[model samples]
Target: MDADMYAEAIEYELLTQAIYKDILAREGVNTVNVQHNVSIVGRSGVEHQVDVYWEFKQAGITHRVLIECKNYASNLTLEKARNFFAVVHDIGNCVGIIVTKTGYQSGAAAFCKHYGLALKLLRKPTERDWEGRIREIHIKMTPRVPVSNETHPIVCCLCLRPASEDQEVRLKNSSEQNPNLVHASPSMRFLGKDGQPITEELRLWIPRQLNVLEREDGGPYKKSLELTDHYISANLGNGIELVQVIGVLIEYYVETLPSNEVVLNATETVSAILKDFESGEWEHVHSAK
Candidate 1:
């Protein structure tokens, strides 16, 4: 076969294997082994090439299934179906299935139906297949920002003095470039009472402290508010310990962002759509083989 034909054949065989494997899994047949591009010896001592093969044992009886894949541009004909039936007959005691990219001729469909052979059409989904289906999703996200205009002095209970201008007490390992901004993360660590290292997640203390501060100030107002009840301490470097947070100057505002749209196209993600010729049942499948 040429390069294009070889590539298409490989893709078609793999697609068939993936679809059947998924179907068997959904049916709770976990013991089955599904494989692609296998060769099975027939009773006549002739080895037949099987595009996709699967077998399982049930009640001490081993059952096999053989699949033939065709990636031709044109529809399958009656002659092709008959040729495949010969292969299935030579390799007896196995179910036969034929999958093609395009639909089959009326005569070929009738021939497969008469011989108990399964005929399936597997191909990329077209625009018509997406009728009444979800094609896209829209998500709206609004961000609330806390803007701090000024931060007053933090008092140290041990020394009974305010922290120096050079001292900085913020979220540890914060990625924000601005030292005045403090971001919240569960992974952030801080020093608690007696200079013991602890996470901000301990007893949900950090969030509770912020909630108390917000409640006492009645939202971010242009005034110096002192937190007297909460005495959560943090050790700034250079032997400076902040035991009391006072005169917090912050403002909260909401910023509305544009809606994010995501398009869901089956043709983009799904490799093929399998349709049973007899029952007219169909499904979209992603290739993993």
Candidate 2:
């Protein structure tokens, strides 16, 4: 039996892991584990799962990497090459790479031609390359960011609401780079619209809420409160009655300020800003997820 078919695919995957290990060393990272998997959003707004994801951290900045290895006997075909596209949005944010012994399908090659990254080709490892090859590539999880419990003026980075509630014991820090994700439904569309997504450039996980969405078009603000009336009137879909909005997430942002600080910072918080909507000194209610 020729060893290049099934046997070679396995061997190629092994070599890919070896290269990943050396990459960590080159990047000043210490951990390595193989067969890493990652699911991240692509430019197409669809989530893409990757074969190998490399991760590391230094001086508090975190890094995520995606690795693609091709072990085909012939030049890559369109379908196989299409695999190389794998729905990546920004390689700038990732340590993007491809490892192929036989190289990519023309389609895949053309896709990755730009973005300033070249696929790294791996030949048979020699004794010299063996020392450089890392036995494995495992990523380290980043530490949870530290937040304080003391209630201060906090703002919703996504919806831009100053009124936010602290879910855990501590109030999360806010930053501009942070984006929030919420499953789309009718009620959520209204909320996101009121949140001024275009101005904030907020990320919307909108998946057809099947409800009327109102937006303030500069010429008109949604004075009718049609959405509010709809949710309140229909009271539809399992415990979805509209409670009178006491306040919005903006207030919480205001309160989370360091007493002396007047202006609230607009940095988006990474964890999530949804849970903080409409928090007044209300008693906690347990809702089953």
Candidate 3:
């Protein structure tokens, strides 16, 4: 429950609302509002700010879901649950939920049972959740030569080589050049439609939550050590492979653990679609599977 953990909790709460937006729509809840820092007037005429608030109307009835995010090192205690229950009761017409990083204590669970409150353990998402989005697509070679087989292993759109192999070489070469560089490498270039080489400065940083390629101590070439330690600690247990390039971390793959809520971190204001194929469609690379 340090600063970083608090920030992560806030982000997770927002993410939860987004992930359920579509489902709420399907349930005929058209006026769903999911937001943070919501102020509500309780029955005692006092206002309180909630971490997350989800509300929708159905059949002239208002339904509200209030979520409290707790990123504590230890289990949530019964006292906290009682305070939350009080807020929910005062608010009225609301389902109360406590999302904790670790879990709830036995006493907290008992309190929740008695009060009909829901508890959810939260963690970062894993690779297993990205399966359905995985698609098999053919890769193209240099000069945009499409591979005939659709099920072929996807190639790096830049080097016209297996993406994994290309990434390995890039990482190896960077580490060799400056062992501290870990995943940071020079930007890749590809041939544009005009037959000229186009430098791909747009790159995605994977394992979204990790501070890889950077040292916790703010020294030189320190990313690998931190990332290695995280892997050993089971922080990055998702079997996710990430590539670092000389650009930006554009795409994000995120999941809230225990809840198994998955989200792609791309906004309508900022998104990139690869459409180099003849059909002019985005190709799905099944490498993540």
Instruction: Report how far residue 99 has shifted in candidate 1, in Å.
Output: 0.3
Q: By TM-score, how accurate is candidate 1?
A: 0.60
lDDT agreement of model 1 with the native: 0.63
Q: TM-score for model 3? A: 0.42
CA-RMSD of model 1:
9.8
lDDT at 236 for candidate 2?
Answer: 22
Sorting all predicted structures by TM-score, with the top scorer first, yields 1, 3, 2
Per-residue lDDT tens digits of candidate 1, residues 202-261?
224333333333333324333333543223344444444544343233233222244455
All models: lDDT? 0.63, 0.39, 0.51
lDDT of 3 by residue, 1-289 (tens): 5898778777766655554454466678666676776999998998977888888677999878898877676888999999999999999998998866556788988889788887765453234323454323334322211122234311221111213665566545654676534322334332343434444432322223234323232212211112211110101223434332222221112222222333444222122221211232332211111
TM-scores, each model vs. reference = 0.60, 0.34, 0.42
Residue pairs with backbone atoms closer than 3 Å in model 1 (clashes) = none
Worst 10 residues of 1 by lDDT: 152-161
